[model samples]
Target: MITKITKFITPALLTLCFAISLNSCKDKPKKESTIVEEKVVYPSDIIPFMDEFKILCGDGKSYNDLVDVKHDNFFYVENDGTTDWVVYKSPNSGVTSRTSSNTRTELGQKKEWLPDTGGKLTGTLKVMHVSTSGDARVAASYAVVVGQIHGTEGHENEPLKIFYKKFPGHTKGSVYWNYEINTEGDNSKRWDYSTAVWGYDMSVIGDTPTSYPEEPKDGITLGEEFSYEINVYKGIMYLTFKSEGHETKTFTKSLIKTDFGKSKELPEQIKTLYASIGRDGSERENAYAGELQNFKQGAYNQTNGKDPEENMVWHTGSETYDGDINKQYKKGCYTEVWFKEATVGAGTPPEE
Candidate 1:
C-alpha cells in the first residue's frame, strides 16, 4: 500500500509541476520588436540651391517650392556610389512647355534679367542616356538639350541651347550649342544655327532613315564628366566648356548685336540645313537686346514622334508608346542627365 501511494503521489506531483511551468510561461511578458525607418534624401538636400529656382516636369507638373521635394523617375537625387547627383529624366513624348514641343524635366530660374544686366550659370554634369529610337536623318533625333538661356519677352525664343546628340549604334556623341535667331518678322520663321564643341554640329545626319554616321573621334561618351559655364556680362555672352581628356573650349558672342541681320549673312550651314524646311528668315538687328531672359538646366528631351518630313530640324520620328512615360523609360525612349554641381548668380567679368 505504501509503495502504491508513493508512485501515485509522485506521478501527481510531476503532472502538477508540468502544469505550473506552462502557466508561468503564459503569464510572462513578451519581448517587443524594434523597427527602424530609413531617412530619405531629397534633391534639395543634395543641391542646397534648389530653393532659388522652380521646376517644370516632363508631365507638365510645375513646382515653385522645391525644398525637400522630389518627383520619382523624373526629378530626384541619385547615388552613384561616391557622389549624389540630381537626375533630370524625361520621356521622348510628354507634356511640353507652351513655347516648344519638346518635353523636359528641367529647372527654370525664378529671377529674370536683361542682356545688359547679365547673369551667370554653371553646371558640372554627365549625359547618362539619350533616346535610342528615332529617325537617324532627323537632326533632333537621339538628342537632348541640357542648358539654355530662354527669352521671356519679345519673340520668347531661346538665345542659347546646349545640346548632346548620339546616333544609334555609335559609342560616342556630339556636344554643341545652338543660337536661335530672333526673327525680324514672324516667329514661325525663326531658325537655329548650331556650333560644334566636341563633335559634329546639328546639320550632320545619316544618309538614310536608319543609317548612322561615323563615330566622332573626340566625342563625349555616356557617363563622361563635363563642365560648362555661361557668363553673360555687359551684353556679351561667354561660354566655356571643359573636360578631363578633351580640349577646353571657350566662345564669345555679343547679345546686343546681330550676326545674321540680313539674308546674305545667313551661314551656309544654316542655308543648307534649313533649305528643306524653308526657314531662311533673318534675325533682327538687336538680337535678344532688352529681352527678359532666364537660365534653364536639365534634360530637355529633343526626341519626339512627329514626322521627320514635316520639320527636319525639330521633328524626330521616335517611338512614343502613345505618350506613356513608363513604357518609354522601360524601352530606353527617354533622356537622362545627371548633374553633380550647378550654380546661378550675377555674371562676373571673364578672366583676362
Candidate 2:
C-alpha cells in the first residue's frame, strides 16, 4: 500500500511542477511584437534633395535637419491616395527673406555655383492655390513663383523665376518664366524679362485694376502637372518644360554674357508691361556670369498685403488679416505648391 501511494504522489507532484512551469513562461516579457508598427513618411522622403538643402518656412522656421521631420502648414508631406508629395506653402503676409517682400516656404540649395561652372535643378510640381485678394493692376497680383535661380553675391537678384498666375475668375492660368536683370548701377534699377513657357507670359494682365484679358486657350489650369529643368551646362542655361496634353518647350540662354543689357535689348513685352512701373534698367554687361548663385524651389508668394498704390508692380494690395496665418489659409490668401519630384546636382554636358 505504501509503494502504490508513493507512485501516485510522485505523479501528482510532477503534474503540479509542469503546471507551474507553464504559468511562469506565460508571465515572461514578450521579445517579438505581434503587431508591426506602421512606417512614417516625411517631407524629406518625398523630396530627396533635402540632404543638400535647407528650408526656410513662411513662419520664420528654418530647418537644416529634415530627414524624418516636417512642419505643419509651411513644409509638410501629403499623400494623394497613391504618391507622396512635398508641399511648400506660405501665407500672403508673413516673415520673409530680408531682401524679398514675398514669403516663401522654399528650399535653398546649400551648394553655390557660378554661371560658368554651371548646375542643374529640376522640379515636377503643380500649383494648387494662389492668393485671390490683390490689386489687379499690380503686376505680381495673383501670381506666385514656383522655382528660381537666385544670385547671392552682387544684387542677390534672380536669374530665373518660374511663375503660375491666374485672375480671380479665370478658368485657366498662365505658366511663365522671368529672368531678373543683374542691374548695372544700383540694385533698385533691376527688372525681370518675362518669357512665356506655355500660355501667356507675365505681361498678360488686366487692362484696368479690375478688368481682365481673354483667357488663353493653352493656359495651365490650377492643379495641372508640369515640370521644368533649369540646366546650366557649360555656362549656357537650357530650359525644358514638359506637361501632358500640352506642347513641350525648350529654350537656351547664354549665362556667361548678357542678352538684355542695353535698353534696346528689352523685349516689347517688358516695355509694355513695365511702362507705368518705370523698371527699364538694363542688365549688367555680363549678366549673372560669375555671381555666386544657388537654386531655390517652392512657392514664393508674389502677392502681399502691402498697399498696391505704393508700388503697383510688386506691392500687392491683398487681404492678409494682419499676417494672421489661420485667416490667410482659410480665406485662400496663400500660395500652395506640391512637388512630387525634384533633383539638384552637377550639370551634365549636353549631347553633341
lDDT of each candidate versus the true structure: 0.93, 0.87
**Per-prediction TM-score to the true structure, in the order listed:** 0.91, 0.88
Position 15, candidate 2: lDDT? 97
Off by over 4 Å in 1: 1-31
Query: Candidate 2, which segments miss by more than 4 Å at Cα?
Result: 1-37, 263-265
For model 1, residues 177-235, the per-residue Cα lDDT tens digits are 99998889897788998999999999999888999889999999999999999999989
lDDT of 2 by residue, 1-352 (tens): 9999999999999999999999999999889868989887798888877889888899989988767878998888888788898999999988898988888998898999998899999999989999888888787999999989988998888889999999889978999988888888977767777889877887777767788888888989888999999999888898899999999998888876887777556778777777776878887678888788999999999988888767768888899999999999999999999999999989888756
Model 2 residue 286 distance off true place after TM-score fit, in angstroms? 1.2
Whose lDDT is greatest here?
1
What's the count of clashing pairs in each model shown?
0, 0
